[model samples]
Target: MLGGISIWQLLIVLGIIILVFGTKKLRNVGTDLGGAVKGFKKAVHEDEKDTDKPDADQPQSKVSHDEAGNTYDVQAEEKAKQKAENNDERK
Candidate 1:
C-alpha cells in the first residue's frame, strides 16, 4: 500500500487518467519526459568531464582593464566591495 492506497485503487486511478487522455497522448508525454531525463544526465556527465581537466589557455589569475587605464586586482576589487558593504551596514 502506497500512502494507504491499495493496488486496486492505483489501477483505477491509472485507468481514469488513460480515459481522460488517450494512450497516444500519454505515450508522447512519456517519450518527452524520458528524452529530458536523458539530456540532463548527459549534460551532468559532460560537466564532470570538464571539471576533471585543467586548460592551459585559462590563466591562474584573471585581469581586466578599463577605458581609464586603471589596473586593479580582480580579487582585491571583490574584497573592496565587501568592505564597502560592511561599512554601509555599520552606518
Candidate 2:
C-alpha cells in the first residue's frame, strides 16, 4: 500500500499527473493553491462589508475644503498637500 492508497491506484494517478505536468512544475503548485485561497478569503470579507453598507443615495461623509484652502476629512489632506509642496520645492 502506498501511504494507505492501493499501490496500483497511486501509481496510475501519479503517472497521469507527471505526464500532464512535470514533477518540477508540480513542486510550486502548493504555493499557487495557497495564494488563490488567501485571495478568495479577502474577496469574501470585502463583499460582506459592501453588503452591510447602505445604498449610495444614503448620505455619507464627505470632505470639503474651506475658503482658506484648508481641507477637512478623516485624513489630513492639508498635511498631505503641504508634504507634496515641500517635495516639489526640494526638486
Candidate 3:
C-alpha cells in the first residue's frame, strides 16, 4: 500500500482519467505541459544570469535621476515588485 491506497486503487483512478480525457487528448496535454515547464525553466535561468551579472557586487535595486530631477529608481523597484507579484499569482 502507498499513502493509504493500494496499487489497484491507483490503477482505477488512472483508468478513470484516461477514460474521461481519452489517450490522444491526454498525450497532447502532457506534451503542452512539458513544453511549458521547459520554457519556464529556461526563462528563469536566463533571468538569473542577467540579474546576477549586472549587479554582482551591488544591491538589486539602485537609485537614479533624470534631467527634471525625477527619481527613477523607485519606479524601477515598483516594476520589479509588480513582476514578482505576477509570478506569485501564476503559482
| Each candidate's clash count | 0, 0, 0
lDDT of 2 at 44: 100
Clashing pairs in 1: none
Question: Between candidates 2 and 3, which one is better according to TM-score?
Answer: 3
**Candidate 2 backbone collisions, by pair:** none
Alpha-carbon local distance difference test for all models: 0.92, 0.86, 0.90
TM-score (C-alpha) between model 2 and the true structure: 0.47
Best-matching candidate per TM-score: 1
On residues 31-65, what C-alpha lDDT tens digit does candidate 1 reach at each position?
Answer: 99999999999999998898878774576786755
Ranked candidates (TM-score, high to low): 1, 3, 2
Ranking by lDDT: 1, 3, 2
> How big is the positional error of residue 53 in model 2, measured in Å on the Cα after superposition?
2.6
Q: What are the per-residue Cα lDDT tens digits for candidate 2 across 1-91?
A: 6578898898899999999999878878977998999999999999888888778458777986566855558467788988999999999
Off by over 4 Å in 2: 1-7, 55-62, 67-91
Identify the candidate with maximal lDDT. 1
